[model samples]
Target: MMRQKHNFVAGGIAAAALVALMGLAGCSTTAGVETTGKTSWDEQGARILEKNVVFNSSSLKGDLQIVDLRGVQAGDIMRAQATLRSRDKDTLQFQYRFDWYDAGGLEINSGAGSWKPLLLTGRETKTVQGVAPDPRAKEFKLKIREME
Candidate 1:
């Protein structure tokens, strides 16, 4: 009779642990679903074009800043331009790339972009431009990093 009681207690503990694990799993799954839904809605929002400028290197960010960013449609083709200003007192070498995205917020040419070199002198501002491969490019991301 005593052994039977012990067995029942062990079984109850096991069941409670299982329930706790399942609750945690359900919470994580719900969070995942919510994140996915929010991402989908953001991609489908009313913005025709989205643009972002990011500096990946800390030194580059300290020395330079993106002054202007704009995109325009030129006869059914998308064109992008950016102005970079150097705040340092010396010449700096940097590399930049423009990643194009479609209307659906999907990258046009994933892993197919080449980095272009740029030189900036102290207190100098320069404007760089890029033309999209096709008219389907409605969004763009500009990434700048320091070059060795």
Candidate 2:
């Protein structure tokens, strides 16, 4: 009887773990979200050249919000700032990376950018900033994803 009960409990634990793993697998998407900010100049002055927001994960789209994205020149290198807000009532762990592009829409380092950790509390608003890898970078794309 004791051996049977032990086996039953172990089986239950394994089953529960498997279910959790399956649920997470369904939500697993590395794509996360992406937003771009660029600078443009003409006769007037510097202006927001382009802005694009893309969501690759539906779950992340519902939990994370991008309030504002802006880009400016810090000396020769371009800097980017993004305002992010958490919609859920729980703290979240995420990773963010910045990709730099030149004036002709070419990526600076391609896949060289490293993912940085970001922690956002419930209903908290935070601004994250990134600096271009080189002076030729005129546009920046910010990507956010759940901690893997």
Candidate 3:
């Protein structure tokens, strides 16, 4: 009976450990900042472009700011750039990625983007750029997060 009880305890510990690992894995992708840019025509019959920035992590929002977001077309491909300002007085590292989308708001090359590293010094201002994988991209979203 003692041997059976010991085995049960060991199995329970292993099962608990597996559950804890899965929980942490689910939280591996911690959202930090997301910014979207789109192009459209306004009611004045003029062309208009917009940039929307959203911060999902309070720590990141307190440390950084998205100063400028610009998107342009180079012949047929969409190019995007974003200027970031570090508010903290210390250097920090980040990972940024660009997600391309079609005119109809569907993602292009979904789940194919790789995160590029960015380094910023104290109160530094820097710009990061991204190019679409192809010509079908008409919109873009920039995502910034703390480097793991």
Candidate 4:
């Protein structure tokens, strides 16, 4: 009779442990799915672009408009526009760099640093456009650096 009771207690404990393990596994899977859904480049690239570009006034700050983005088999073509303005009567000089990345989250090689210069008048707004060099570019990043 004692052996029978011991066996019953052991079986109950094992069943409870199995249930707890299954619950933990489910929670782990949910966390993994949530983490993987976010794009790797979204936060880092966006912050870099915004930090370097300065807006004199809330009204004059240029808008970063994405006109078109087409995903090709090997690469992608992204069309973007930006408007710049200065609240004070001072001319501003700026430069931009387009960084391309492959599917494996690595930056592809390009000519030099691939930087382009831009100029703006006081309280003047402007737009800019660019094209990708090749097809292996799955993603792109724009960095605007203030000069002078």
The TM-score leader among the candidates is 2
lDDT of 4 by residue, 1-148 (tens): 9999999999999999999999886664211000001123465464112222333323223322222222223234433333444444567666666666656757768554555777766756666554556655555555555542
Q: Write one digit per residue (lDDT tens) for candidate 1, span 24-127.
A: 86764211000000011255574243344444455556788778777777887777788888999899877777777777978877879887898998889999
Candidate 2 per-residue lDDT over residues 1-148, each given as its tens digit: 9999999999999999999999998886666999998888877784665889999988889899999998887889888999999998999999999999999999998999899999999999999999999899988999999897
**Which 10-residue window of candidate 1 scores lowest in summed lDDT?**
30-39
**lDDT rank order:** 3, 2, 1, 4
Q: Would you list the clashing residue pairs of candidate 3?
A: none
Off by over 4 Å in 1: 1-51
Better by lDDT, candidate 3 or 1: 3
User: Which is superior by lDDT, 1 or 2?
Assistant: 2
TM-score between candidate 4 and the true structure: 0.44
Give the Cα RMSD of candidate 4: 19.7
Residue pairs whose backbone atoms clash in candidate 2: none
lDDT of each: 0.69, 0.91, 0.92, 0.48
Candidates sorted by TM-score, best first: 2, 3, 1, 4
Indicate the TM-score of model 1.
0.64
Write the residue-wise lDDT of candidate 3 on 37-130 in tens digits: 8876789987567889999999899999999999887999889999999999999999999999998999998999999999999999999999
User: Following a full C-alpha superposition, what root-mean-square deviation does model 1 have from the true structure?
Assistant: 15.7
